[model samples]
Target: MSPLSALKISLPLAALLLPLSSTLASPPLVDPPAVPIAYSLEEFRSAVRSGGPGKDGIPAIDNPRFQSAEQADGFLDDEDIVIGIYRHGEARAYPQRILVWHEIVNDEFAGEPVSITYCPLTGTALGFERGDTELGVSGKLVNSNLVMYDRATDSEWPQILGVAIDGPLSGKGLEEFRVFWTTWGQWKARHPDTEVLTDQTGYVRNYRRDPYGSYRPLRGYYHPDSRRLFPVMTDDERYPPKSMVLGVRTADGAIAIDKDALREEEVVDVSLNGSQYTVVHDPDLDTGWVFHNPDDIEIEASNLTFNAEGVSGSGLENLEAVNAFEAMWFAWAAFYPETAVYEGGEAL
Candidate 1:
């Protein structure tokens, strides 16, 4: 028999003999539900037109290995970027050096299943709860963001929106957990006891180098001037296409706070569709967070802390928290066309 045919036949036999975890290990290929047209065929084709590699082309790290902070010191550089997640007292860091190859890391933190996703193209790192389902890279890009597929229902979820735009779970959104996008130095300093994801992932990949580019001396697609690799559905020029912004979505509407603007102003209070919100930047960590400002609290930037409760100060009480993420201008604008941009003094 031909090697291809023999391998194909052997796969089923191997699956029958081995456990499901070993046989159908990859989430993308495991128990995919029947395909259903969730959006207009034309729209789906438009999304497909902004093509990427086939399924599993950029593999998802299903089973990951981790190391202690002391062990991670040998490999991680101070300037290296990492997505830090802290849940229920457990902290872990997923380095960009590794995530560039595996766009998704199916991991568990504090007994809760979480999918840590990084799209090098868009420079976005997000976390979502997998619940009873598993998520994998569909090897697709919509608006330059990674399109993930759920194993249980075969629904397509765009990383930026965290909502299923296609398939069985169309219109459904996954619950998100906050992830800190910061430098290794900052993360390690904050969480000294953190566990770091090691290069011991089952897949054979070059974990040291990033295919997109380096963030230290930014080059390749990550360069400040680098143009987008794919076309977006729409474009806006309020800020540079590559400008990084802290974007927040609420039931009323969405807003994008320019990172540079926030760095200058430190704190921005804006109203989105009559609901007030505050965006505060942390210079030490080079990170930001948004919080609901129902009382129109007068924020003191120097004393501000973007904590989970809200932007807290010495005298001010904690406010309600709002979900926000840092994303490139073009990517955020493409997904949320009506999004308002926040300049330094006032939201523009």
Candidate 2:
């Protein structure tokens, strides 16, 4: 089927040379609401009609995006970043202004050579297979974001702002795992504590040290606050996101979370102070996101518990995915504080 896999899925140059960047004001096209999630063409041809995972071979590229500093976007480039498109049959649409300006791409579809991703720090758009090699596409970039490999669970993932790098080496790929559950619920409302990976790859993506994006916090990726995921693989096993981040108890008359399967989610900066209840930790690992705060007694229970007095329960989990909001938004006000109120759009 290689004719470039029968092409046809082009929609930007900004939407055919500028007309859909909200008519042209051009700095705010993150409408975000595709989140109800739907993919028919016979459920995306019954999720790739089993032509793959039989593991024949054809992957190659491995550049990048979404390790989350705001959900990912190192402004990568592999040119015209289309990546995968064989028409409604192998459908995969990832365009957040070309993933906020090229953070990753990988390429090919239909002949079945996928790897479409985006990461606006966590606005996620995931897909896999770009390794084992046949010049199919990892079209090879890494320093340029958008890599992600899942060679029959050999597992390798990355993307900076053409999202998808959701915690714990995410390599499930059933109909591309509903596009990684539609960018992992926008990477859990923007990395709400980023953690799913444990030790993925690419020299740990840049391996940890957070000057708050001032450079030095790239490390074995995914830990926005313990929603931790970081496995790009090569025997470099830093795994975790097969599952587990669900540990919430929240307090104040009662506020427990984590039911699973992703219950119609979309929890942006939910706050209520005057009682010092500043809560926003869907997975905000030291500001990776889901913010909002007023300051008082917000007891979101999970793991990283740190306090001085009156109120000491800040450890929420349940992402194991999302995009951050901006150069880490002052670490959600110095470590997972709050402000992520999505009306923006797209979870479908």
Indicate which candidate wins on lDDT: 1
TM-score of each: 0.86, 0.22
Colliding residue pairs in candidate 1:
none
Query: What is candidate 1's lDDT per residue for 55-83, written digit by digit as tens?
Result: 66677888888999899989999899999
Model 1: residues >4 Å from true position, as ranges? 1-45, 305-311, 314-318
lDDT per model vs. reference: 0.76, 0.28
Residue 191 Cα positional deviation in candidate 2, in Å, after optimal superposition: 15
